[model samples]
Target: MNMSRRKFCGVGLLAVISPLGFPAFANPSARVRVGVLKFGTVNWELDTIKHHRFDAANGVDVEVVYFAGEDASNVAMLAGDLHVIVSDWLWVSRQRSEGEDLTLAPYSTAVGAIMVRQDAPIHDIPDLVGKKIGVAGGPLDKSWLLIQGLAQRDHKIDLAKEGEIVFGAPPLLSEKALSGELDAVLNFWHFCARLEANGFRRLIGAHEAAEALGASGPVSALGYVFREKWANENPDVAMGFIKASAAAKKLLADSDTEWQRLAPIVRADGRELEVLRDRYREGIPNRPLADEERDAAKLYAILADLGGERLVGKASQMAPGTFWAALKT
Candidate 1:
């Protein structure tokens, strides 16, 4: 699929950068240590960056560290063992409110959805009443909160009170949904894609739910999170990584061959692979940073009302500097 280069932000320099390979004599000081979840989607972009030497082209060396879980990655980042990690802006907002200097660069706008079996009686949020609904990431999950908010606003119904909500890991919820144990399931984007591949139908996507809640456009739920102090000290290296990331997104957005190359690492094949590839491409953040920030602020207000302080911490509105404006393309 051919796409306009304009869709990708901050990658104009790619035309001038040598595409052959990394420079023979590179600066050793421009190295970035990125911590990633072992099976996270972030690895797909990071892999593309490394496979195509996007980091080298942008005058930086990216060192990837794999973790079993996001909490472990967060621990490594807080311990100064890693310079960057992929996480949501909400967490960044909460951390900043607590005096942490962390900030985020927009990564993906992809979010979860409520999925039900194709033959199931569930057709809408109202249909979920008194039905067993499997929710990944627990009660305070942004996706779950958004669904609750949407349900309250549109139908005058409270899903939490009217439905049987079961919280569990994404994979487990997906399995239960497939086995008919769950009337519906809300899982992460990749898991949702897998469910879709397996003939599950989406009752409502989080993006649509956000729009119903007054979001002007697609808002990125996740980003490349890093310390403000570290970015300030290594401005060039930070900007290089951002640029490399943009270039990688551009490549992935335009190349089916690239997705095929990533088959093994993605651990998917056939219809599942195609669905995952399409969903990932759909998640590429294309709007301007200002637009994203504004929508995120609106979402923060909605999520805060539903999730309360437990999810948002001490921050009232999304803490200032939640979205790293300096990294805006």
Candidate 2:
């Protein structure tokens, strides 16, 4: 049967107008993509992803992927590929101020410390002058903060101008320092212990570093994050991850046997599992972000005075209301 052009046009229009038609099939529900750091410990969040802690039978399906570092994880979040980032707090203020819809949800475990060689000419923070100081990553700001804090208290040295430090991520600095590739290095957790056993000296721990900076104890060190829009849409999944994570934290915190349980899953470059076990027991602690607005404000004030004013607006404004509220129970 030959159809007229007007009839053909009318049929095409009907296809577009049909509510219960195949056009509905074109759209698909988004799967939750979670990102983890490559060499990050067997913490609660990573364990949750590994052991399928979150339920898929509900509404949304969750998938886990590992990136080389937190920087890469942030890139994934910005690209909309990741629903959450279980990593550091440095990105929180930086991302939020940029107007990115990302928010911190809860705290993870305490990361570890910075180490130097025992016999190295450097004894105190002031000794790190023209001599090279190796950190895990080049220009590693986190490690550099230790030097900055020490300088501010002991010598009034300006980190921006007076400090000369270097950073190298994994295998690079660790391997080099072990094999005599560099002078002294800053390390974390298991790696710090390894450096000590291998004859490297302990210069400073993260907690001690914070203290020297004239601050109080164990500030909110590391934690998790999610896009604001994504978290709002999938509150169930968010809550599920948090619940599973809290459980893992309790397990790790309570017993020495659980530390052994985590050994096989945790890995570090040039560091043994036993060292990691000790680090896990001593260093990492599962704690929530505090209600101390003063400390939060202090961090912002320090960063701003240190030329990181571009990263945050005001110290008083840096509260963990939405994210911290999520961890109440």
Candidate 3:
């Protein structure tokens, strides 16, 4: 893949500066450690981070950590071991409330349509009444927002009520739903493609769910999160990461070939790259925070409605002292 001159310069700068020492990550030690999720759709940055033709230029050693969920990343953050966390919106909100020094760095992927078995009775959001739905990543997962968005607008079905929905991991839900153990699976990423290939039906997404709810907005998508303290202590490092990311995004925008290069790294079957790439295209746009706060608020409302408000807390509670604050700089 080709890189612009700016990207090449960024890479060179990272290499030149990495030898200098710092308390958080010392010089002449292991490469600057950065935590990354192990999901197929989420960690696509690794392709650019590791092989951006500028990896050595970034002056930081990238350490990819495969987290089972946001909670795991939180545990790692609390331990002060991981430098960054990347996942869906709800988890980010939840992490913020707990006094974790994390902030959204940049958006990665947009939440997409919910899926069900093709033979399943779930034809639309209204059909989800009394149906068991597969959910991933606990209450803070994007799937929860989709469900609430559906209930609040289309079905008028209250998510707060019991027996309205059943949530579980993709594998378990897929097994149960496919084996007649459940009615529908509300999942994301490779599972959607996998389930669809196995004859699952498309139910709804954050986008479609928003439309159904009489809203016009792109919901908060995936993002790069890191500790405020870490980022503050290493402003150059943080900026370097984002700058390189911007460069990578430019490459992606410039060529499907760039995406083709990144696809195999994140995709398990290499077929879902199209799906993943599409989500990426509609998401962050190589920038940080957007002027709009509605999507983030929508996520909070859904979490509050789902009784996860204690986990998500208020927007005011999410401080401006973190990486999100840095985005402005």
For each candidate, what TM-score against the reference? 0.94, 0.73, 0.73
Task: Write one digit per residue (lDDT tens) for candidate 3, span 88-196.
Answer: 4556656666666667655454554567766666676667667666676556565566567567665567654533456677667667767876676666655665666
Cα RMSDs, all models: 3.3, 13.8, 6.0
Ranking by TM-score: 1, 3, 2
Minimal lDDT window, size 10, model 1:
1-10
Residue lDDT tens for model 2, 1-329: 22222332234334333455331212134355678766566343356433533223222345678887777877888898877776555557666655766776445334445566677787776676565656664443554565566677678766445544566666567787787756666765556776766777776676676556655545555566787676666665555445444444444556656555555565433346556555555544333334323344555555555545444445335534424344433
As a whole number from 0 to 100, the lDDT of residue 102 in candidate 1 is: 94
Among the numbered candidates, top TM-score falls to 1
lDDT for residue 280 in candidate 2, whole number 0-100:
55
Model 1 agreement with the true structure over 66-166: per-residue lDDT tens digits? 99998999988888888999999888998889888999888999999999989988888899999999999989989889989999999999999999999
Provide the overall lDDT of each model, using Cα atoms, as 2-decimal numbers.
0.87, 0.55, 0.58
Stretches off by above 4 angstroms in model 2 are: 1-32, 42-45, 52-62, 109-112, 119-122, 158-164, 255-264, 268-271, 283-288, 292-294, 307-322
Which numbered prediction scores highest in lDDT against the true structure? 1
Ten contiguous residues minimizing lDDT sum, candidate 3: 285-294
Backbone N/Cα/C clashes per model: 0, 9, 7
Give the lDDT of residue 43 in candidate 2.
43
